[model samples]
Target: MTTTLTTPTTTGPSRARRVAALARGETRLLLRNRTAVVNSVLLPLLLVAAVPAMDLGGDVPLGPQLLSTAVGVTLVFLTYYNLVSTYVARREDLVLQRMRTGELTAPEVLLGTAVPSLLISLGQVVVVAVGVAVLGEWSAPVEYLLPLVAVLLGTAVMTVLAAASTLFTRTPESAQITTLPLMVATTSLSGLLYPISSFPDWLSTVARLLPVTPVIELLQLGLAGRTWDGEVVDAGGAWAAAPLPLAVLAGWLVIGGVAARGFRWAPRR
Candidate 1:
């Protein structure tokens, strides 16, 4: 039998398309991980439910604190914590190393790996906002646009932190320990559960300096516009807190970038 063979096209899938495919694969893997799925969805909700017990100050109210808690907890568990384990798992499995040897660039691989987590984090943020809105009325209108800046910037910071932390993570199982410092420190002192305004002058000042503080601050500034009487309040207005936190976020981003330069794609020897 005689047959004619056709040559394949010189152009394959576009770069964006390839990256998208990678993200899809990453998302599927995340879905298959039962623990990851549960933590990403349920953990944030559980954490936020405790806002009633948190002292976000008398003026801040449980509703506003709940909203802030939802955003902060979701971002931490869904994006930052998840990425640490995922990156370590990929490194241990040799997936990252294999990708480096193929057509996918390092940046593409990192971005692709982040896609699933980022999407879930954003979804959690939405759920938090909706639940807060549906529960009752905000004393002041939600500054939807301003807090979005915090979410976007905070996510970038967390992504970098995850990448950096994975360098020390020996295995997927060790991810919990490697990730604990950040989770514990930030949750306790970063105002993730409580408001900075609820703090004494000394504590609020110090809290603002923590790596995670700016994120929680920005989220609260945007989502929780309640007034506080006995606690620390910044001069000027709610917007006054914006610039300093933004600058702090930028500084952390730089540090994360510097740390990433030493990232080891291959397993540690």
Candidate 2:
């Protein structure tokens, strides 16, 4: 006679317990690593402090501009760059593969691993927001709430992007090279170093299509309580008015979801 055997299903606390244990383990690993800690925290702090000294002045208030810039930088470095590096490192270490055999689902494993990074990012944002509000004299307009939404959406997109990027990264150390293209391109084009309005027409058109552009536009609009009304054109000279930054942000979320669907917890052959 042939016999069938099935694995037992995990119960509520079993799932929660697995997530909690993973969170603790990941947190300890992150905190113990000096380079990771500095990259995650110190770098963002320096950028936030340095932006005000550059004297990029205009009709836009310093408060909103600094706040927007600070938050944007934080989102990129903390959520995007840090998460990608960490995920690659863990996968190379077989941490991700081991976790998959536990009670956690793929989504749960990803989220659980990400919890520590997310908490650190959120803490940094809060601290920077307070500092900007006090020293930079930043008071966000009521409409600025919309940009906060964009900031959040941007973080989610960044997380998924990190996951997808891992497929190309074979080792933790190689992540720096793999991540550079997106990081440099997004940082330059996303209005981190310069305002998008100042870009040449052709460059601006291309920049608008990059994921970071919409997030930055949303931040600028939220801080200033305005929207982008400029023309966006493709190479063929087919032009359309820029959609509301909010709409652009929502679209990115959809794209991130699609990208995330293909992310693998185990290495692909």
Number of the predicted model whose lDDT against the real structure is largest: 1
For candidate 1, the lDDT comes to 0.72
lDDT of 2 by residue, 163-238 (tens): 7777687777788898899888888887767777778988977777777777766665656653343333232221
What is the alpha-carbon RMSD of candidate 2 to the true structure?
6.8
Over 4 Å off, model 1:
1-13, 44-58, 138-142, 197-202, 226-236
**What TM-score, computed on C-alpha atoms, does each candidate reach?**
0.83, 0.82
Q: Which residue pairs clash within candidate 2?
A: none
Task: List pairs with backbone clashes in candidate 1.
Answer: none
Q: How many residue pairs clash in each candidate?
A: 0, 0
Model 2 CA deviation exceeding 4 Å by range: 1-18, 228-243
Among all candidates shown, the one with the greatest TM-score: 1
